[model samples]
Target: MFALLCQLASAFVGAVIPVFYSYKTIKKPSQKSLSYWSKYWTVFGSFLAVDAVLSTLFINYFIPFYEFGKLIFLIWAVCPQTAGAQFVFDKMLAPFIHRHERKMDLYVERMLDSVFTNGPTLALMVN
Candidate 1:
């Protein structure tokens, strides 16, 4: 079925390729490879966050062939010829993140502080 095929494609394009490429980059570091993968990860992470929220809200149900569309996007993101992830990061995500960088950092720091400070208490409460 289309859904199964899409899932397989998604796994390959989204996860397998990235993991392999990341390993290669780690093994042999170069400025070009580091820069490209950094941009790729930034864009990919943004996509995953947005996709999670949309899927949680069932927005995919309204869009026809959402899986196919997602597959195409994943391919575009990772495909060397297009360099879509870098394009997207430079054009969209970078600006947005830069603008909110201070606030986001503050929030993350606060959250981590809370977790570390209250971890034992929280764990006890959970049980």
Candidate 2:
């Protein structure tokens, strides 16, 4: 039961990270930064390769405990799960991000402004 729960959590987290990254980085349809194939495969391939090597070296051989279950977990973690991740990102997370993007940008701008123009610079005011 504990192992199953851990596997599920790992799988879900593995799915979410790429989706969140893509949602945060890529622009909308008109101003898209990466083509569909490029974005999908870039995230998928990178995760897959990393997961493969790590699973092979550590999960499969070095540690040599729960090897079968860990490989199964890795499969669920990597695989073609990106499509589902992207769907979740698009349908859920993307809307929330779009809604708050302006406010977030403004907050960042003000934070940077204070850092660069205020504080000790108060003494340097040249007007």
Candidate 3:
């Protein structure tokens, strides 16, 4: 149960990071006109969240098939899932952006910290 909570939280934060970055640095989206922002993230989150649930079910429910099906699952499940996740990670990472344009240093720092925390914690949880 706790593991499930962690996975969902990490996935949610990971999904939204890029949205925040793009809004903050690249386009400077007006917070008032965030309809597209809300929709984009909703779509992104729903896609990843659904796949995550499906993948978990498929893995646990079909152990024998999971091993043989890893390749198919990688293509059908993991790649898209990870792409959305990475999109969330990559939005603000470019040259010549200023400090004020950064939105807040603490948020970026926490996001980076999440990567470190999630990686090792995920490895430990899985093993």
- Index of the highest-lDDT prediction: 1
Model 2 ranges off by over 4 Å: 1-78, 117-127
Range of the 10 consecutive residues with the lowest summed lDDT in candidate 1: 2-11
Tell me how far the alpha carbon of residue 61 in candidate 2 is from the true structure, in angstroms, after superposition.
29
lDDT tens digits by residue: candidate 3, 6-53 = 455544454455446555744766753354345345445555566678
Q: What is the C-alpha lDDT profile of model 2 across 18-101, one tens digit per residue? A: 466557556443334344434444445555676688866766445534544554544443444445435534565468658999
TM-score attained by model 1: 0.92
lDDT of each: 0.91, 0.56, 0.50
Roughly what TM-score does model 3 have, to 2 decimal places?
0.27
Ranking by lDDT: 1, 2, 3
Question: Which digits, one per residue and each the tens of the lDDT, describe model 1 over residues 1-127?
Answer: 8867997999899889998999999999999999999998888888889999999999878998898999999999998899999899889988998999999999999999999999999899999
Off by over 4 Å in 1: none
Question: After aligning candidate 2 to the native by TM-score, how far in Å is the CA of 23 from where it should be?
Answer: 18
Point out the worst 10-residue segment of candidate 2 by lDDT.
Answer: 29-38
Highest TM-score against the true fold, candidate = 1
